[model samples]
Target: MKLALILNVIDPKIGGVMIMGDRGTGKSTTIRAIADLLPKIEVVEDDVFNSHISDYELMGESIKEKIDKGQNINSILIKVPMIDLPLGATEDRVCGTIDIEKALTEGIKTFEPGLLAKANRGILYVDEVNLLDDHLVDILLDSAASGWNTVEREGISIRHPARFVLVGSGNPEEGELRPQLLDRFGMHAEIRTVKQPSLRVQIVEQRSKFDSNPYECLNEFEAEQEKLKRSIIEAQSILSNVSIDYDLRVKISEVCGELDVDGLRGDIVTNRAAKAFAAYNSKDQVEISDIKQVIALCLRHRLRKDPLETIDSGFKVKKVFENIFGSS
Candidate 1:
């Protein structure tokens, strides 16, 4: 559900999500499924940086050289990035680095772009994120915030657009991530194993059918898939028309202040999430109901420590939201 809301906000300006869940909860599967359902985007065929097909004329000379050589300049619709960043991945693997082979063989000063380059304008999904290196996390955060990737090595400097939504997943029982990195995410969600008998049965049955006859199962769900795709496209089409009422802005700030959230991120993220929610609902204007629906998703992880005993920050967000906006 939270993923659907986040998908509706997949502009270059919006941040990504963090999902914490237990094993066997199908975290990876759900991410893959949602990604599979996303509509293909047009990109320059055979381009390493994955530049949009529509933006080819503005591309750098290096990319344009391939086109100039008659290297098949047709635009192709390809699936967006759904990269999985596993543990033990090195910095050179995640960020661009000196192209050793080119330097050694041709005496050419060149760069080898890495996963981050491939993930430009796409989703960089990280599983077991708690175990990842902090420096890598910082690289991701920097690129996301600045919408560019900068790398310098072996007397060569490179910078390219690296806008992406970082979808990070981890099991909290194994370890914890630093607060600074966690706060960078736009939204957070928690998932667990299904406890209800009927729900569990339904889930298992669906998986079994998919496993047994994948094509048939996909055919059966084709209508639903197209529906979801249309909704996302529709949401994107209307997102530019959504606006925030001034009073609602005050209410958002009030709730964040009441919770004693760390920085203005809580306020900013809530505002963005509300706008996306309104867009998803086909509303040109944001309403308090939109904010109310998404406040918890935006601020759940941004809350300060509670003076009281253990309590979910989401619950606290709901309480503060109702108190400020009057549960309308």
Candidate 2:
């Protein structure tokens, strides 16, 4: 799950990660901790949407207008937004609402930005996402894909930049997202509660240390955090230069085809993920080891459900991968 999250941070275009694990597995804690690993982003000064200074597609309407008018745009570094999407949130809360009264009285559309706006160019995390309304889930996925959110009230329509890495976490026991919806996520990571007694004890000890001396604990990890932050920033800089072999690409697609995965999403994600993984490792060329590492994460949830099959989806993907590309 940590690897998947880091990869998404390196390239939000890899889409977002869906994490499924047992309750009390530190899903939320880990997701929040990743924010610390992220480097600060550049945004237009005083922009509510965290609009980029130069990327027009990522800028809000007001910022775009200012740029068009040859206005001096100021930028500042800020932490990437990490938004928690509550289960009971209404559509208006997730997508900004238009003030109908103002629209009618003043003949102007007054738009109030919502969570999506706040999450632009950052992370939007949904806990127990399977329990969220399907329509809201659709809206989130659509905005994540298109990088824009459109809210129409009466005859007034307002759209804004809504690019964000959409991360969702849930326990399989509660419920599961519809297969179609699950497939839309770029990667899926499954984690389990620690089974080793020593590991469990160490986890408890770590938690106790943090709770008792939060400052000390943070200071202890500060160097490590900065190192990881530097690595992520460097990876992002060289991601486009990372290349995957054509044979590997064909083999990745072949694995997807053999697994009966729907659509070309699995193939595309695997390719992108492999490239990201390579870049993360500071390698310019993708190796079979890289593909082997991320193939299952990218394709596991995309496989067709077979009720009678007892094998794990990830294991099935690896088995197919080994057959096609030979054992790593």
Candidate 3:
């Protein structure tokens, strides 16, 4: 679907982007393509936490083993961490718990890492995120915000970095996300089915070709995908140098104030999104246009409720932006 370009702009390494759309809009496919295009990362063999060069989630025993043996820890090539959270997961499964198998076999209480641990320094995808259990949503929101997972239950206490770009997709026909949880997402986009007959036919043909010979189709696009991978790596290096100037800050704060967004998070995300836009355009300094492009993504879900009408927050934000920045 060539969605890699849009995804590269909102990739986890650049912070995360949350997508809301209909079922057949290629959201999942876009995620898979992004995973395929990203560079492989080195991880510990057989480690559930996907331990990397500086993984702090390693158990004390594993650390001791590495130290005592005086053997260089080996690196295994694995796909960049992309963990999907199924809709029917329990709290223990999502946040980790005491390993029952280890306790039963060795009569010891060893902590077992869960999905959050596995998602370190990678992407976490949740389909139908709007319908996820409230408590589980709370856990995800907390980790997404704090960049750490802390567990205290059954006399087990541990805290490890669980930082990851949270990617979520859902059908708007179902229900909207809770305002509190919605604020945690850094960027938001709404996807819809391609309505044009020509585009619909193109989508079907592409899927048919892919299904018949997946490897062949992938090989055909491999070169283009590799080019994108190099671009993303370069973008990451350049993003740190992008500047958010004083005028840009004033403009950002003014937009939030005009919109009456609840808290400081709106401004924070807006700033980050503007910086990301600057990086995407290969510019060192953010421009007014950058702010215009990202304000909707950063603040769409944070607006006050209006049950009388359905407003696309992106459109509303764009209107406000044009009013302030002048149509360009």
What's the residue-level lDDT of 197 in candidate 3?
100
Clashing pairs in 3: none
Off by over 4 Å in 2: none
Best model per lDDT: 2
- Candidates 1 and 2, the one with greater TM-score: 2
Tell me the TM-score of model 1: 0.91
lDDT of 2 by residue, 1-328 (tens): 9999999999998889999999999999999888888888899998878999898899899999898999999999998899999999999999989999999999987898999999999899999999999999999999998899999989889889999999999999999999999998999999999999999999999999999999999999999989999999999999999998898899998999999998999999999999999999999999999999999999999988888999999999999999999986
Lowest lDDT 10-mer window, candidate 1? 3-12
- Give residue 319's lDDT in candidate 3 (0 to 100): 80
> Which residue pairs clash within candidate 1?
none
Global lDDT of each candidate: 0.79, 0.93, 0.75
lDDT of 3 at 60: 30
Which 10-residue window in model 3 sums to the lowest lDDT?
Answer: 1-10
Per-residue lDDT, model 3, residue 143, is 88
Residue range 113-219, candidate 1, lDDT tens digits: 88888887677888888889999988888887777787887666777777677878899898868888888888888887888999999999999999999999989
Minimum summed lDDT over a 10-residue window in model 2 is located at: 32-41
